[model samples]
Target: MSDSVLLLRRVRERSGEAAAAAASGGASSSPGPAPRRKRGRRRRFYPEHRVYRARSSFLDLSEEQVLRRYRLDKAAIAGLCRELGADLESLTGRSHALPVAVKVTSALTFLASGSFQTATRDSTGISQSAMSNCLAQFLEALQRRAARYIAFPAPGRPAPPAGTGAFPGVLGLLGSMHVALRAPSENEVAFRNARNFHSMNMQVVCDAAGAITNVVAKFPGSCPNAAVLENSALARLLEGARPEGAWLLGDRSYPLKTWLMTPILFPCGAAEERYNALHHQALAALRQTRALLKRRFRCLDAAGGCLQYAPQKVCQIFLACCVLHNIALRRRMPLEPPEGPEPDPEPELPLQAPHVQISSEARAVRARIVQQLEFTVQMSCESCAEAVREALRGAPGVRLLELRLEAQTVLVEAELAAERVRELLEASGRRAVLKGMGGAEDGEYKPGWGAPNWAGGEGGGQTGPGVPTCVPVASLGAAVAALSGPGGVRGLVRFLQVSPQRCLVDGAIDGLQPGPHGLHVHEFGDLSRSCDSCGDHFNPDGECHGGPEDEHRHAGDLGNVWADADGRAAFRMEDSRLKVWDIIGRSVVVDAGEDDLGRGSHPLSRVTGNSGPRLACGVVARAAGLFQNPKRVCSCDGLTLWDERDRAAAGPPPAPAPHL
Candidate 1:
């Protein structure tokens, strides 16, 4: 301690002597003003306030140096650095590349997270203020540089060299718009961005390969795809892409203009005609084709139609499908040789058979049948237009008029093509007008000149102005019954003669199952399957019963339908207690799995139906008076059965099944 103290004293004495020497040399030192005394008697200068500046750290250095020191991949860093350099050049005049990388990292982090301070600070280790500046610079650079990448490419052609024309690809143009909420004001407390933001409709043009070609974002109030297309960058891009004779496909939402676009028609387009004669012929052929398909395969569904073959990619899947369709047409279609017009057939058959005299009674019967046919045709025509007009009143910008000339009776037809239809419907902003015909065309008479009134003309000449028939939703059940059978039960009911004297329950499943699954009758036709539809329990008599084996069990509690090895469930119950006719608004549900009713410790798993998901649903119906109902309606038992199987051989039976 003595030596340390002596050394400290010597240093102090030297400091003091130096001060005195300085003062003597006119430095003006009076013991440095007694070293600044404190208010306390024994106070001295504070050691902490020694006036030393903090050293700067390399941690604030630019991104490139950090990458270099950190031994990052040179190429990746170089690429990123180049991007940063470009961004920096675009944003600011400074050419130094160091700050660009920092800005790049900052901007990416900011855009991705929507928080400039947090994302930039965390990613680039830059201060908050620096991060904000970098982000601003980055955004400005991006807008300028984006011009190179956003141009539209031509469809079905090769892209020119870099300095030449644009690229070629099949463009799949789709438009989607989003509405933004309004911003919060001084008077209102801020809730969410939705309340204050404006929405943007994005018209995105994608290639058949599903790559994005061009995107135009705007906020035009209530504009439809067609209207938007007319004004959008995508429209311009598309015009150039498919210069001449290129196909443009869209849903019915597009206007029916006779532009170069080929509007791929849906099933509804089957009715569209070319000319008067050809229209009828084409329609007949189409109808026959559809009938044959339904009778033979019954594979096509109204909704799925052709989408089953579409690719998994979401953006340009439609375009790809079009390409596939075109390819298949090229390879597999059978072309017919051109034909010349044939001479008209002779008015009379060439003496194939000699005329024979007929009884007066037979002649009278034939006359009666012809008279009935005439009545039916007349009634059908008068009712047709009203029905169609009712269907179209909700459609805006559509006008209708009856076409009639002296003695001729025919339905005049007019239509906007599918694309134009889409456009107009969008402009009107109403429910989309799917494939359908005009009011006058909705009726039943064939086109041609009408016979004189007393001669029994088919056109009933509107016995009076036709009364508009309002479709009653509740009458669906009775309607189905009339269409099928007398009692509303016979048409769908099958009397399967399991044995000659024993007629077990018969009838095949209708639309109950697409393929096959577990089908069954619940104890509660009431559909206490849930409380909503069917009333309470089928019995509600408070009968005590348990399990499928219980005889006293309520009607609403039938066990499983038990499928067969082929996954089809076919069973016949002589339970005279089960009434199929009264079961309207009730249904036969298909289950994906078997119902064990919580038996066994495995906890009775329901794989489908209540069992799991409801796959397909069909309601029971009885066609009352609508003759030749176009929609398929079933018998009381919900089967498409007929008595023709009585004398004729029955069709091959369904395969045996098992529970789902």
Candidate 2:
């Protein structure tokens, strides 16, 4: 047993003494009854009992501070907490779950500022995982109650008639906006847009008061606006049956449907122009609603940066924000101020041809003119016209311009009396007779003088007093041929007279891409030069380009035809404006792109509806009828061989052969 052995024995005795003290719950020298062991329980620190808890800061916040930070008043916040607690009790499954107030505050803070989960947890005194849970639950609750906040007007309360208000009979205005998002890992190509950015196209329908009535948030950014609407449940509802006279107002991006009214692509008459103006005014509400929604929830704005969630979660968040927006509107909460300068406006689409330029000075001078006088002046030659112009130049308050010697007409912009100008012109040795003058008993322009009655009269298809009320039923057909290209596009377009004022157009075009294409009747039937010989849309009434249902649309405006995934299109529609008698021998042209129906932003929209180049064209010919003759050719040049024979045999026919 040397010194090493003694050291070992001392170590062992000390260890044994320490073990005995631990078993007794205290050192032997300081013993009391070992602390009584609790059975089947573990001790935990309750934050509620602490003098200062992690969530105490929320309680200390002032009412105004809470509202400013969370966009909810004290009353609203408490209500939300109560409702959420009741709804989430079963899911949470905790007799003493996290306080409802704490969960709501955390979720609201995250939603209001779009902060990360870490930041939200730090500020709200909840764990990051707990914060995520709270937010998801809260969003779910809001979505479940969305119907309570957002709804269409009741059927019993019909919207007012058109022209009665800012957006008469307009239940909602439809539009789409982009929402930024992280690139999805699966099917990433489907989420990328032309700009190479990942996003979702959120379509919203807002009422006249700027309240969002419907929202579709699942479409990928690559989806066109029109496609999104066509795929939506709302589209099915509208297609199946629309509310009587209730329609949605949209921009050119949307297709013109019986339940959805878009602006005229080209405004021809005052009535169509008025419709366009009112349509724009009504659609503006959608823009304002989007602005307000993004302003209220910075999380929804691009400025806040893209949301770092999966597409499914992103959709949920969007819907939750919409629910909150409707709630804010109901509660009359003060919205957050706009965050920064607005983005620059989109550039205007280029016009097809440059408009005639007018100098600013000329415009100003024209604005000051109180009256204009048009007169027929007898001037023998250019020398005489020069003398009359010089005489009028010296007259007081008389600016004579645009002298057409061939037509013997002179226009004078003046502030003086018309009689005085006539006297001055007559004094110059030229007999002047007033043809027209401004500020007369009649308005600016008399009926059928300035603007032609394109549709003849409101009751269409009645030619004259002795003419039949109904035009004879007729049918026309076209063998659609591809334009001079390699796309191999071909189809047939047929027109069948359904009634005097209505006709059915049926078309089947193949060898095209899957999407909308412009289908229309052109003014000319000559295909010798391909589609070039086909003039602009057949606007016999001198009307603007619009949808088939438009009151003042071009006779050839058939709107858009959609192609299936197989590059085949089949279209059938009834139009009151098109008649087989009118369109026979005309050309049916298919455009390369969707027709904007003349309401597009491009200047060419006025004339061409902004549809791209012709893809296919064919001459519309009388299929089989009294008017059908394969060899017969008639044009504005006058009747052919058959007309001469008819006149010779009948001694003046009862009525002329229907002019082509």
Candidate 3:
């Protein structure tokens, strides 16, 4: 028999023997010293449940403190408790029942603090077991009444305020945010967003007043915005009702529809240009509302880190927070700036899209809107256009580029962050301002660089064996220099003679703002006055300071390298005139601005390209190459090769130049 069954039978047998003994003793009319019982172990008893009276109520805090901690003032909390009512209050008249306010407070603390382990114990003095009960009840209440708090405006409601760029019939400003979450146990890969973080994509629509009118949550992070909209309940409702002239303003990611308005990807005329500008203004309401949600409910904020909960629980928690956020907005709860790192300012762009058919009515509406509106990056010339293209040559996640010289606008469609692209453009010595963004349809007349295929491409596994672990080097003539300068400018440049007439130059420098800097070899390696003592450009042939491609240029003229947004300049260039053996002991330098290629009117243009002040330089010394001296650790300093690599990777902070 099973262990529990056997134990139960044994207990029954013992009880029967005790009853029989008591009956016999009573029949004899004598106790007989209680049958001389013998004792060994005592029986243990446990109560069915334990009543725990918590130490303090969170309601003891001041009004201001309450607003900051729970994101709801006392009056609002009271109203919420009454709304939840007996559903939150203890049902029994047992010893010191937990008040409904305590349960509400515990749930609020959990949401505001974004933690389950300490939120309850620290704020409400309740055990996790009790907190679980409170939070579950809170989510249940929200689930039942979420519709009451969040709803779209009535169809006949007055057109939105003119403050939203004076766009008539704007039903709401639509936006999407990715809510980070703990990796789910099942289907985990789907949770990875475009940023490669485990999260859930949440779509929201807010009115001009910054209240959330509709929210769709629980979609996978990898799911694109257009796909989310196509599958959302709101989309279905809009399609069924077909509200005339009323529409939603979404970013370029969303597909244009009759009831969903999107910006023009390429504004060819004054009307289309004005439409995009006004569309941006109307988008502010959605951004503000989304920011406020994450600020108040940190569980959704990335700064708070990923939410530590199951995938299903995460959805419920977000839903509950959204409902509470609407309630807070209605009650005029003030926005509080977080004490630490804030959420990302730019919203996540829906970089990928699934196939979806667009109605002809949608295009008709967009064309009509463009005719009604009139309004207005500098790609004014071919050189400027070429500079932009060169900067973005190898940029990752970039898909499309369309530049218009007449309009001085460039349309870039990329999965990459806008900030990164901006840095690349500035690196070309040109200011790039993001006017706006919109989607590109299939078979559109795209100018400039043809878009890279976002789907499968022509690459597969390589046929030939890849390079070995050994670093490549030029054994014939190789030299190296470790460059360090003022304000954290530092780099390692390697010079190698690859052929009889060609020399290879490559290195990576850090600690520069996003832009171009002149690179050249100086006449001397002297450090007596830091960079000032490096003398002029190494013009052994008495040539002018020109670009690497110029025949009449100095042997030291290596041109410029671009720095990305993170202040890292990585470059590789080849020069025919730069002989590795000729300039072994000379110094290479970087300037503070673009090399004008002897084209400027300044007297120094032919001598220094008017490329501003010398920033950093280093002396060249012969070094081993081509599988030579490939040791792991240095015998003299005891520094392992990996250690050296890590040190270079960490980089140095900005400081004054070193002196001899």
Candidate 4:
């Protein structure tokens, strides 16, 4: 008993001693819940002061090097930094923001080189994610300031410096270029272009000084230039504003409108030839401007590789590049060497029939300037005549100058003022007297010299004085059949001759896929073997297959029809080719694929317009009236099953039958 009590006392004392040691150690060392784990500081790749210093001293690079690397001079970079500083600070947060210069440099590197984000990160010394964020933010800032940097000159302003001998009053040059990109996951076919590259078609309008004034950067690369122009805000602006006496010079890829001018298709006379020459000279500015833009911003170069971004993002990048280009021009930065080949000519589309009219006073003014003038010069010898000829030959606006020594007279054809010609002759030390103004009396002007062929009479070959004022109405019924399936597409289409050159076509077809389908009028009305029996497009003029509005195209080319998701397509278009009186008994066919309007690189484009197989067929027939209402007729001849059922239920109207 004595030994057990002593052991228990020893154990109790040891336990108390152990508990005290544990509590003291826990309070001093273990602490409470790890002290809530302090967030670790991010390791700096470079010293913060160094980053700040790098940004602040960005202009330390020579102007040439900066222009070569970033397509911006030191002044431009500085201006951009100052302009974007506040916005950048707000986006990145003042406390942890990267220097404004760093963000701008990252964006400029990407734009100047058209390099990928990873490449940009390596050059910028920033993480790829940070660079990406920086690019997005920079683009946003540029877009906000775009209006300030890029703007068209106001109406009545002096024309920008067009190339040598450019057209007068040309406000800007309109053109488009392709920006290559990786194919999108959806609608990849829609973005595949003639070059077989996925891209975006960017439309740009630049002043003669090569400064971009406007940009529309969202059209799919496969879209035709004409279609893009026709569907752009620029078109609406030109249409509504109709900037007085100002014209946008463009290549044939654009249509001829009052506010937009294109080169004459087939120039007839000297005046027309001169106009065409000037138009081409003016349009050269656009081509050179595009080349310069791509040269300065290599990211836009096709050689830089397709941009790896979504379509919308790619558009933003394009617009941002345009803004920077304008800014660079403002800062007088020299352009770099072009990075790729010049863009190819755009595919042709249906030409829009020009609706502009030339005023009589304007025509007279043109005739007066562009005319043959005969003047009597007091020349004594052949040497004198030779001297006069040499002097007139070097004149700026002279088209042709002839000096006759025997008659002592001089004849000149030019776009020169009468007083300027007199002064030139007088300066040559020969007294000259004006004889005739325009090689003939004012009332005896030649057919093609007074006004543009389009302004006077029917020049497009489709419209003439002999053409009827009103085209008759016509209707066509289609029995559509899927190329590979048992189901069929069916619809009725009506055509009305709205004017001498325009025919309005309205129809609805069911059972088509929800995409673009080729629609055309076939040459034959035969339906013996369905659409296959119908010949090729109704090309009576022996013309190429093109859109209905094309200057030289098959009469049957009606272009494309887009179907809705519900497999129904309703279309109404005013076609300049389809005269209601011309296509009677011909067949209308709907095709399986989109129509390339005869401009596709594929061989089938020449014949079938690259539209797949015929999916539906119908015969054209004369209609009693335009848009004849088909729904007015009775569905059933005043009788119904319900009426019969009621009569039967009422015991067959026995009393009425007896009275009869």
Candidate 5:
């Protein structure tokens, strides 16, 4: 203790001598009096307060680097700055205030990357505290001006890309997603969703082209989708006055309103199944919208991790991201390095576990759509459907046969073309138009379903074989006719007995003037005069020459074929009177003018519909149906079906044009 005390006293004495020398020298050198130091007090001094001016990150970084970090191009960012820069001014006299662009970039980095203060500070060279302030300011600005970007179009405004997704009158597609966030100090339990995370359930409505038309971000994750929709401004707007016939599409989680169409929970019929299938097809666009949203701004998805922000700030941030999304779309900015493949929608939405009865109005809307599917036919009830089934039964490649007499639309999933299906349906004195087509790619028709229990089997999980339907070859009664004529005219016609009362007449003729032609079958198979030798119409019963549909018309009055400017006439028709078996030994004739269908003023209209001079004719003969006739070389000419077809296509040498 004695030595240590002596050393401390010596050190203090040397420090006092040094301070006294400095004070004496300062007093002698300067004109001012030397300041006195209070006893027992230590002098405190600091290094100079640094003035760090944050340069604009946009200026220093390359465009690609900036877009990678900030998720917006230079022009888009500049446009955003012009939109919000005036609002971000600091009126205080701080000399080294942050530049507007630096603040914007800092805020954007946090928003796009969904990172914390540390991550944002590294990207924008701003301190953590500064970044927090910048983000708060940016979000506030977005919230105040969100109406300019995120909006629900007013009633009667051209619904953007309206009805393009094939769901008519669709104003928007409604969807909900859970956004992760820090648990709020208040109501933390409400924020924890079934996903086992604290998040806000955001309701978004998008048009067909993946543009956000409306967004609701205030609801907690625990709230049901229907409830959130109920409380949204969009609901109020729609309830007040929706456009005539307009509706919003939602998944089954949404309740059915007059203006909100949702899928049927337990679809019982083909119509309901198709409605859901088509509904899902339309929702695919909504999913694409979600894809683009999450891709451009990772903050909206789990890829960005949980946003470390308060619940209120989280809502503002969602709004802010939406604004940026729209701007990017408007600026035609593409996500260069897009996010990973899109996530499939949750098979079932959360918080909709509570069961509720479908209201009568909901049932009515469902029934209306099911009924509106399509058709005009003479028959009604299951009897008509049975008749249709009878026609398609034993038909080759017919996988799924759904006959809804009420809807009058028969859905047949088969390897056969839709045109063929229409022809088959039309055979029963009915008309069918194809509403949609699928399976354009190879193996697109998944048909493990040839034996159809129309209403369906126990589980709905079994889908068709996506590959070409592996169907056994089935047989039908068929006939074909080959036409030959002067002046390079050639043709082929096929007749198939689709049912007892219906026959499909499909054929093509080339080298005729670009106009209509009367097409009819004759009683005789002889084509000695090319067409004139084939006797009068094939009228088994004594009947007048009338249109195919007329009750007293001759059996041979099929109708007319209209040729294009290229002098090619391809035609398909269904005639109830012309049976393939009955017409197999007859001949077909083509006239020069349109058939008047026996209702014109001309004297010969009753007998021939005033059709002009005959040009080409062919003898009808029994032909191999699909999968029946083996391709044996003809014993006489050594020509297979394809070889004969090629010779017919080549036709006789073109007749020389008359000298002008």
Candidate 6:
């Protein structure tokens, strides 16, 4: 035999011995010679032929040597596939370098499935060492290939002027981040290590033509997306790159960090939030964006299985799909049929407006174009509508900054009244204002008095009016529980409360007890169970009723309390049988006139809302917790109750508070 033949046989024999030893040492084995081949078994079915294994290099193989050794012959591979059951012309072809291509595809498939190296060895008839070397070389090649296909050059690196000799018109820049898969275990680790990284984040910036302008991928340790540009090859290309007057758009996740590349801001107005029915167009567009994002999320979830090295790469691939989306959008697809055979020439007519109004139309077409051009600015995405709405709803003393009704979007500016924006949004009748301020405590100020016969009166055995009281409930915990409770009183109602801690004005017509005044409960304790359960107006009777004089009846109809000339209406009429708390769900209405013990003719009546001109309203508390009156009652324009309080705290006419 030739020296080469002798070396090959010896190497094969050694490899077999090593494998047998490893298998024997790994687990228990019978001490016996290998079983002889069965009579019916094919002659070719030797131990080596029966099991596929990775080919080993000739001990001197370098990285280049290994790659060279596996460089599959195109014709030979095709013939081999034909000899097996696989079709060559049908399934494999010229564009693909068969066995080598198959090798690449198989590696990718293995990367995705996470099959063991042993399994791969069996399938490819390759040795463990050869398979390992193959993987490293394959990945390096893929990185180069993907760079050619997916990565973008940095900003300043725009290619030599297009063959057309003019830069593409209306360049649009889009950016997204994706997770790359690193390992099967890395997926779980990525979620847990919020600050660390088990996968790399991939960022690609694309141009109007959907060509990649920049590409970056890196492990997100403590670094942020803004910082990524500094480390990536894509960023190097972007150095000194200026996308002047370009329209750059991104989701909320994009940071506000200033970049050397472009200027970006949200498309929505300063006060106007996104997504809250900001006219029909915004709403529709927002819905479409949401659906698209949802699909992207689903794709990301599916990628977890295939991406092992930086598991998030699965997500990175998914984000690549976004670039495809932009390309599709640019193509004006799903394509439409030509309107007619006689297609009109491109006209100078105006484009349709998103929310067609003089202001909106003007802004979208002329103003926006001019403004962005003058400043070389890009536009960021509108905040998620749901997020903005939830914020607006919770903010206390929220001022409506701008309400472009034609645009149908409400812009509200509010200082944080609580720990979270949601808390402020949830309050009842929480209307956003443009200016001015008023709340429960506003009524507390003495606003001038009524006649001796006024509602909660004093003097002459009749009633006199009193100032509205705005008191904080002591227990917020109780309040939350009460309102959320099963029997919690909600909505409109009228009922009496005999307790010193609670008060309610009547809305019922019969005076609830005739000949005298009857107090009642309103609604909304927030489950506070505080004195402020049941908010205003209990009167079931629409017209203001039962006062000293005859007038139209109103909802707050309790008549004047009996008192002497002294300014006081004090009486304790508590009956265990006439439970007040039970009546919380109901109203205690007063009459159009005094119930005069069922006597006195001439239609015998008095006061309108029982001699009370809408004295006060306190929705009883429930579980919602202590209602903190806004420090500033804003009319909405930006004025706050705080302004008044600060003014008051400053004191007197001669001294204006010094501006900070």
TM-score of 3: 0.50
Say which prediction, candidate 1 or candidate 3, comes out ahead on lDDT.
3
For model 4, give the 10-residue run with minimal summed lDDT: 472-481
- Name the 10 consecutive residues with the lowest summed lDDT in model 5: 437-446
Summarize candidate 5's per-residue lDDT along 369-472 as a digit string, tens digits.
Answer: 43321222334666666666677665654433355566555555433433455446655544443332221100111245432211221123233554222222
Backbone clashes, each candidate: 48, 4, 1, 2, 6, 134
Q: On residues 240-310, what C-alpha lDDT tens digit does candidate 4 reach at each position? A: 76444467877765655667666645443333455667667767777777777777777777776889988
Whole-model lDDT per candidate = 0.32, 0.65, 0.70, 0.66, 0.68, 0.32
Q: Tens digits of per-residue lDDT for model 3 on 485-594?
A: 87778877766553324566757788877899999898898988888888889998998878889889999999988999988887766677987767878898888899
Q: Which residue pairs overlap in candidate 2's backbone?
A: 265-597, 265-598, 265-599, 266-598
Q: Mark the regions of model 3 whose C-alpha exceeds 4 Å error after superposition.
A: 1-54, 156-165, 354-357, 373-660
Q: What are the per-residue Cα lDDT tens digits for candidate 1 across 1-660?
A: 699999999999999999998778774544434467567676666676454223222345454543323222234334545754755754455523235555655544443222326543755666667666775565455445444444455455542211101111113434232222222232222222121322223344433333334555443323444555678765565545553322332323343222212121211011111212232222232233222211211112111122121111111222222222222232432222212222121121111111222233322222111110000101124344343334434343222222122311222221222223222322322222121121101112222322112112112232235422221122221211100111111112221111111112222232232233333333233433332342333444454322334455443333455434433334433232233334444443334444444242343222112344433222334322112232222455454322222211111222221210
lDDT of 4 at 67: 74
Off by over 4 Å in 4: 1-57, 90-96, 156-164, 336-660
Cα TM-score of candidate 5: 0.52
> How much is 415 displaced in model 6, in angstroms?
33
What ranking of all candidate models by lDDT puts the best one first? Answer: 3, 5, 4, 2, 6, 1
Better of 2 and 5 by TM-score: 5
Residue-wise lDDT of candidate 6 within 23-88, one digit each (tens)?
A: 987687656787997788556534543543343322234433322232222232233234432321
- Per residue, candidate 2 scores C-alpha lDDT tens digits across 1-660 of 799999999999999999987888654557556688778777876777545335644557887687667887778888777776776554565644677788778878877777688887888877788889888887888778888777755545554444322434576888877777999999988887655678888888888777888889898988877788888988887667655546777776665566676654433222234446767878777778887767666677766678898988888888888877777777888865544645322221222112223233222221222124567666768876887877776555666635888877776655554445655776666666444433101111233233211222222333344433322122231122223333567765655442234455655677788999988888998877778879888988998778767787888888998888987676656577776656767888888999888778999887888889888788776543211222333466477534533442101223331221
Candidates arranged by TM-score, highest first: 5, 3, 4, 2, 6, 1
- The per-prediction CA RMSD against the true structure, in angstroms, equals 31.1, 23.2, 25.3, 27.9, 19.5, 26.3
